[model samples]
Target: MKQLLILCCLCFLSAATLAQATWIWYPGDYEIWLSNRMQNRRTDRGTFFPVFWKMDSHYPLMDFHKDVTLSEPEQVRIYAEGTYNVKLDGQPFEGTPTVITIPAGKHRINVKVFSQATVPAIYIQGNKIISDSSWLVTYEDKEWIDETGKTSDITATKWLHAGSWNFNDPAILPSAFTLPVKPMAAVKTENGLIDFGKETFGYVKLNGIKGKGKITLYYGESKEEAMSDKGAVNVDWLTFDKAVSQDSTLPASKAFRYVRMVTAGDIHIDNVSMLYEYADVNEPGSFRCSDDELNQIYDVAKYTFHLNTREFFIDGIKRDRWVWSGDAYQSYLMNYYLFFDKGTVLRTIYALRGKDPVTSHINTIMDYTFYWFLGVYDYYMYTGDRTFIKEIYPRMQPLMDYCLGRRDKDGLMEGQVGDWIFIDWADGLSKKGPLSFEQLLFCRSLETMSLCADIAGNQPDAEKYRLLAADLKAKLFRIYWNDQKQALVHSTVNDDVTRYANMFAIFFDYFNAQQKEAVKHTVLLNDSIQHITTPYMRFYELEALCAMHEQSYVLKEIKNYWGGMLRLGATTFWEEYDPHESGPAHYAMYGREFGKSLCHAWGASPIYLLGKYYLGVKPTAPGYATYVVEPALGGLQWMEGTVPTPAGNISLHVSTKEMKITTAGGNGILRFGSSTRPTCTTGTIQQTKDNWYELSLSPGSTYVINYQSVK
Candidate 1:
């Protein structure tokens, strides 16, 4: 009888342990709060530089609740980040009770918190009752009292499932969240100046310091940038008076490899070290090839991407570490093939969206707004997280509505006052009146909305969005498609064609075969049209080529462009690479000596290109339930890599004469072309075309194929 009782107790303990609690908040509230903290950290040479646009904050008051039925009476422990009140079954707990006993029955637990500085978050724990995303939270409770002190209706109040990540410990508060950091010594030091030897970001620590005066630390991504006290983007000035030696860590995290310290009075430092602050995300996807230079480029791209991926996907580690929607859009794509960190992607999306009364476009840029929609679309494509889509659907509507309301009389997007039409950083780029590129992105965004609406179960809205997308797509072709130019013009202002619209159209599959070919020749191949210098636009331009089976050409371009940056001693990729420029001029941008970011998120496009285009692994269905792997050597002798999906890693090894493919999970199709008929040892090959063949791939199976090289 005792053994039987112990067994029952063990079973109950296991069940209770399975129900773990995590810190929770109103969805996106913490993200907005954290982004404000991160974005405001930017400083330009000791001067605080914030975003030009208005910054939004979390709701000052929030109400969180959960409906639960307990089998036995239990005491629930509560922790909150702000001033709070607790209630059980519509009855208020005496006075913010830390532990409250609930009778054995059905009850609704509520925690209302108010905070102005940080997001109102809570963590609750009990044997059967725990706080998690399952709990619902809202900014407004809308519960009122009548004249007689009776509770009024709150039927109109909207609630959403709480947002949470890995924060499960009771002692750890969500508001006190920070990235992990590690201490590292400087590689070399000259007098007061210290160099870490590579571009890095984090808090600077001055060890064994005894000072009685002011010390100015100039931070720079490049050595030249660090040395130039006047030109450095971020600077930290410290005034200290200490009789005994002590260590002082900088208050704010800054990005720099070289730190030039200029001290006044009696300031002494024994040594210099830094705490490298970085996001805790694992790299599940990777790429390597036969070419050593290409391998080097890939490694550098990954590092550049990692450096930019922190609290959110910022544009760069240094100078303007603000989350730009357009730059983040590229980061999302690269993320799918590198870290596959969906949490970061969702966090970034939420941060960018903010709490919208629908004022201005995201990042105050027109194209950026569309890219935000596209980012959501890709997120769903890669992760098939319908709950996320449903949760964010309401937010999407307002943004889309904002875009729709801003359309010109011709029913196209035009740059209005305060709208930065940042298509690229190129000089003389037209932002005037009804841009075709904007219209194209608008159409894509609408299509994304349509797809998401269907997933979100808004049938009528889905159909409406579909019609809007179709109508806009038709208009895009009708207005911008230049038959003579054989490409969509940059803008219809004077019917001048550029590569942006035509390139995007090709990859988006908006064009028919003939039009795609024409655009490829007339716009993409034609150098007379304004060349896309920024790696940002080049990402799409090259993607268009890869989509059109121009991998061979695109490979050369990637090497020439990305490899050119490598030759210039770029430890990480640059924001923009202009091969024509020379010496320190290469480092200069925006009319400043060191304005260009040496490690921009968009510069890591090769990670996406090689993974998706060359390795040829992409989801044909959402969440990679079904995917396609069509490996292209792209002029390399051999290549092997893993592309991460929500399901698992889809690995590939390809050479001139043979190919091998394996997937951890998912239904996949292995497609390739060869001069001769291919033979697969593990699977049967079906000839899809004259020289093309396709093989069905099953999870946990390796398929090896031997074929004559077509190229």
Candidate 2:
């Protein structure tokens, strides 16, 4: 009777543990597998179009194990994909038993699975042990025996914490994972053309359709492209011999604002709608200002971000839905100020840095490789996930070593035969010689590695990378910084003073105060310098401007550029925007009729700019343990925003007459400039200069101060 009671208690405990059980696989295995599936889903002109780079798959066979201690015997239920075997204390279980009994005391459980079609994964639930990230997983293929016919020490075998993406349900296999979708009707349909009223991504839903012969739907980001055959970037075709009289949705999701439906023979169409598929990410960060135009820009930017944010942070919804490292880097920064979706950020990072033999740069772009490293740096700074840093460090070292080995005689990174020096999509852009931009990003990446190494407890490599970064930073200045030009020249061979390197240097803090001012005058604000037409590079250009306290000027530029797109009836932001171009010409890029992605992820820069620069809330310490909030009105009458942090949300409202702030949970220092002395009863105030004042704050404090804004 006592044993029965104990078993009942153990059963209850095991049920509780089962709630936490989730399917687990080797880290980065499922990510690479899912990314390959997503990247290859792209199609152009009714034909499949995939990424040029090599796609990696998950390991077919995997071994997962865990050692546990229990005060009493407990029952464990096991579930897994693929054929598998179980072992307890070196004794193999007969066949594959789903239910097993473990005796009291210490025991090690092991599950081996083989799945060629998808990632081999497992789930186990017991009183104290469950399949989760705590379990170690490996794909070690080698084994050796001693002279005594006993297995040798397996210490050399590589094992890592199993990866789990919150798949708590045992029935919902990771291989069958798909995003949620909902029905969406078109806003208008005129003359067989359907418009969703804004840029959207989903499968086209045919309602009440009885079709025969061929049916074609051309998708486009603009109205003109949907109506023209050669202009539309995506198309779907279907054929029916007899009227089926049923609702049918397209197989793949596509990006489109307008769709031109063409039918042949007995095909009949009642209405046009869609099943909109979207990522479910939270929007904890928000912004509202007196300027209506800027508010619209923020809303549209948010929508753009939502479209690009899927299982991974992709570049865009339309063309090239592939995860580009450079694009994902910008998305990560914007995410810090918006969704704060650390999981999505981590997934994108892992997918980009796949299982590495260190063959080539990420996305085959030199700058993109560095961007991936920088993404890791920012991820730690924002989320304070030290475990991820340590987990990814082994791969980081090899990737960085691959980069270090690719240097020229002077320890500079020059474009190699296979490397694509894709700084931006600009015409007449030179891609020869050792580019200053690559070196600048490379130096930043090295510094990131040093910081990550410290977090990962690699002291020797940390110092080595630190010194290497320092030497490279010094070399970059010596080789590229032309004192007369007051800007980092574009490349060693061309020596053109472009905005890419110079603007990046300012915000990177690689340049001094005098150098920042000089670059601002010569490159950033210089009219003679070739202008940056793409939103990709413009993100950095604007960030550099904002970093220099040029918020007022940057605000005007934002209005002139992003607001300019809004003025032209843009439902969502574009990959590239030029005031000089108009109508259908604005939609053209890469020598194609409609190659530009209208709703690009990088187009959502206002979210980052307004949150960090204008509202002026940023972390002084990692994970917002300490942060600084320096609100800049930037010619606005009023502005209020909430910046998401790992702890909580930091809310702020600013006007010429008053300022209000409520910290989420951090040591905050609020800095502002006043025309006159400001008075506050909420906190202690210190005057740093003639106009600037600083106020100290603690966690969860709501402070209201009466102040006059300084011009």
For all candidates in order, the CA lDDT equals: 0.89, 0.90
RMSD of 2: 3.8
- What is candidate 2's lDDT per residue for 1-711, written digit by digit as tens? 999999999988756655478999999888988999999998889788989876777899998989999899988898998999999998999988999999999999999999999999998887567898999888974554332334577655566889989898888899999999999999999988999999999989987788577888999899988998877989887886645677878888999999999988887877989999999889999999999989999999999999999999999898899999999999999999999999899889889998768798899989999999999998888888899988898789889999999999999999898999999988788988999999999999999999988887778879999999999999999999998888899899977888898888898899998999988898888899999988898899999999999988998999999999989889899999989987889988888988888999999999999999988998888888888998988999999989999888988889889999999887989999998889899888899988999999899889998999987
Indicate the TM-score of model 1.
0.95
**TM-score of each candidate?**
0.95, 0.96
Error of 2 at 456 (Å): 1.2
Model 2: colliding residue pairs: none
Count of steric clashes across candidates, in order: 0, 0
* Candidate 1 residue-wise lDDT, 444-485, digit = tens: 999999998888777888999999999999998888888877
Name the best candidate (by TM-score): 2
Question: 168 in model 2: Cα distance from truth in Å?
Answer: 0.4
